[model samples]
Target: EPEVTQTPSHQVTQMGQEVILRCVPISNHLYFYWYRQILGQKVEFLVSFYNNEISEKSEIFDDQFSVERPDGSNFTLKIRSTKLEDSAMYFCASRTAYANTGELFFGEGSRLTVL
Candidate 1:
């Protein structure tokens, strides 16, 4: 079985600091997504990437947030300026094709804590 892997499992940073969360998604997956879950809320979609372009994004994904597949295997989410509300469990996920067939593989998560 394959799985997505994220780095810096837990990060603590002060407000206004820059933060970059990294993930290496399953090699064969075609679609990649970034999601965030506030402490007690359901997961919210941030952005979806395919073919080196953004396929979709949510309102929460403002100018301050950006996603890029820098190379063959790494996908990254960068928040230029952290805020208290930015603290949450950020998840990276990928699926081989579409939601109808392949299962979405999710990384354990990169927990961000903004002080």
Candidate 2:
């Protein structure tokens, strides 16, 4: 079975620092997405990428955020400046194909902590 993998399982940073969360989705997946859950809040979509370009993005993905697939096998999300509100569990997800019933595979998540 294929699954998504994330790096730096846990990270602690200062409020004004930068952070990069890495993920590797299934080899054959076509769509990749980044989502986050702020402690007691619901999971929120950040952005989606396909064919090396951004396919969709939520308002949360503003100027302070950027995503890149530096290598064919890896995807990364970078936050230029972290804020206390940025502390949360960031998840990486992927789907083999888009369909009415397609299922998304999610990574264990990289927990970010900002002080």
Candidate 3:
């Protein structure tokens, strides 16, 4: 079974620093997304990418964030000027193109901490 995988399972960075979280979605998945869960809070959608472009994005995914598919296999999220509020578990997810209602496959998540 294919699944998403993320790197830097946990990251600690100083406020105002930059960070990049990486994810590798299942090869067959056509839709990819980045979501975050602030401790003790509900999960929030960050951005969604399809066909090499951003299909949709949430308010929280402001100018400080960016996503890329650099190649055929890797998807990445870059956060510039990290803030204290940016601390959270960031998840990378994907779903098949045909399964409009398909459940999203999520990675274990990369925990980001800002000091």
**Pick by lDDT: which candidate is best?**
3
Better of 2 and 3 by lDDT: 3
lDDT of 1 by residue, 7-94 (tens): 8899999999999999999998889999999999999999999999999999999999999999999999999999999999999999
Reference-based lDDT, residue 25, model 3: 96
The residue-by-residue lDDT of candidate 3 on 1-115, one tens digit each, is 8889999899999999999999999999999999999999999999999999999999999999999999999999999999999999999999999767888899999999999
Model 1, residue 15: C-alpha shift (Å): 0.5
For candidate 3, give the lDDT of residue 79. 98
Query: At residue 66, what lDDT does model 1 achieve?
Result: 96
Pitting candidate 1 against candidate 3, the one with the higher lDDT is: 3
* Pairs that collide, model 1: none
Q: Say which prediction, candidate 1 or candidate 3, comes out ahead on TM-score.
A: 3
Worst 10 residues of 2 by lDDT: 94-103
lDDT computed for candidate 2: 0.94
Off by over 4 Å in 3: none
Question: Runs in model 2 with CA error above 4 Å?
Answer: none
